[model samples]
Target: MITDPQGTILALFLAFCRMGGCVMMLPGFGSGRLPPQIRLFAAVAISMGVLPVLWDLIYPKASAPGATYIALIFTETLIGIVYGLIARLYTLGMQFAGTILAMSIGFTAPGGHDVVEDATENALTNLLTLTGLLLLFMMDFHHVVLRALVESYAATPVGAVIDSQKMLITLTDTLRASTMIMLRLASPFLIYGLMFNVAIGLVNKLAPQIPIFFISTPFLIMGGLFLMYLSIAALVRQYADGFAPIFTSF
Candidate 1:
């Protein structure tokens, strides 16, 4: 039953190019905390699993040997990166929202190591980002992303020339949509911070000798923490819910 070993291997590698590219930038799987070996093996395993399902669609195109095959490799990898970035942008938006939330609420504690990346981040921002990502994992976001990758082959068939313009548009749209959602999530904090700071400023102007601004720091942090306690569950739940529509629509 076996024949064309070379073709099969070639097809598998092609499949790997896409799946690996996607995994390289996927949210939970792509976190810097994860060792590269683990990610590599995970990608390899996923590619192996997917290759069988896509063998018919991919093998024919893959069997051809020439400069065209090299082009195909680049095209497939680009498509995968595009798909991964769609999900990545949403998660990055959460980080952005967290940073804004921290700054607004005066919760800018000394930066600690980020749970997901190499950079240092404020404690509150780290908490928010970690909680949001964990919730997404609990909700099985990876399954949705994998399913999307499979569906992508249908929307953008194997060996189709990459559409640079469309790819750019899709990425831009993702950034726009994610930013709007993150801003909405962080809006309450933004408003609260603005009003609180304004009141503090007014008091400072009225009673210039009291050192009111310095005095308010503890209260600001306490109130912000209390507000976060009251609303964080809903914030994360909404963040998780927002992902499905964005990923599925694209």
Candidate 2:
């Protein structure tokens, strides 16, 4: 029943090359904390699962083992990496928003190990990053990304000549969109910080004898925290809502 064993194996490996590349850059799955062995096994499993569906598309090209086959492996992996990076960029935008929120709200605690990644982040950043990622998981964002990956094979195929220029443009566009969304998420804090500082400055001018900066620190932080408490639900909801449009566009 198992005919063309070598061809089957070669096709499986071809599938692995693309999937492994994607997994290497996926957000939670590709975190530095995850063991390389686990990532390898995951890619292999995904490849095996998808191979049957893609066999007609892959096996014909793969059965001919030669220099061209090696080239196909390289191109397939690149295509997958590009797709993975698109999602990775969007998630990283959440971290950027967290950092902005921390600074704007004066929650500048010393950096500690990130809850999910090895990178050092302050408590607020860690909290927001973890919260946003948790929301993504709750919304089954990984499933959306995997669906995109599976659909990508039909678009890019196994051995098509990849347009490096187009790939670069797509990444740049994602960065732009992600930057805008993060800014929107952090805008309220930005405005609060600005207005609070301006009012503090005016108060200091009115009473030169009073150390307004020292007196205002607690109020500034308190007001920011209270505002965050009020708006956090909407903030993250907007964040989650924005992901779909951005990802689908690309």
Candidate 3:
């Protein structure tokens, strides 16, 4: 049995790298505004917690650091990234739903505060996204996230090469399913918005002298906001229900 302190440290560092990569992209803690130092600190905490469990499984020899051991670190990091990306895909559901809702409510404009971290998204969309994230936290969804992380170790082991084709297929299926779900969630709003717009357009067309467009704007906004409030509870419940099954497959 290999018993070098240097090897142990190296092994730990490598394991930490994989864990850190995953934490960097994980939800809640991986928010764009979070400070890097804080993210790193969280990663460290997670690595420590996971180390004892993984050390024996990953660090077979404590002797000299061999080439295979070094390669395993890269594999572990890749596996971590894949796992994290799979979890992160769920956040897209919010984006999908929010975009549809905003479009239906006529708020999908090129508004300010349209950027979050590295991506461009309007304020309304961002608001809904933030709401979804906050709901996840309020519900202690992080526990579910942690459970998924632990489950990944069994589903997709460390030092194992990922099946890229399979992952791609899964990703595509996730995006499609999420978008469809969002469309379904926003269907009521979409129908309402469409009917309202058509009616308002007809009024404008019939009476060219009236300022129907300006008058209808506030009514539309008020109606949409009310509908959103009405739907909020059901929306949250649906998200929670849908999210639980996602981890089971991964």
Candidate whose TM-score is highest: 1
TM-score, model 2 to reference: 0.96
Ranking by lDDT: 1, 2, 3
Comparison by lDDT, 2 against 3, better one: 2
lDDT of 1 at 159: 86
Worst ten in a row by lDDT for model 2: 124-133
Estimate the overall C-alpha local distance difference test score of candidate 1: 0.91
Between prediction 1 and prediction 2, the one with superior lDDT is: 1
Q: What is the TM-score of each candidate against the true structure?
A: 0.98, 0.96, 0.85
* Clash numbers, per candidate: 0, 0, 2
Of candidates 2 and 1, the better by TM-score = 1
Residue 6 displacement in candidate 2 (angstroms): 1.2
- What local lDDT does model 1 show for residue 175? 97
lDDT of each: 0.91, 0.87, 0.73
Of the candidates shown, which would achieve the greatest lDDT relative to the real structure?
A: 1
For candidate 1, lDDT tens digit of each residue in 62-129? 88768988998999999989999999999999889999998888987789898898888988888888
Name the Cα RMSD for model 1: 0.9
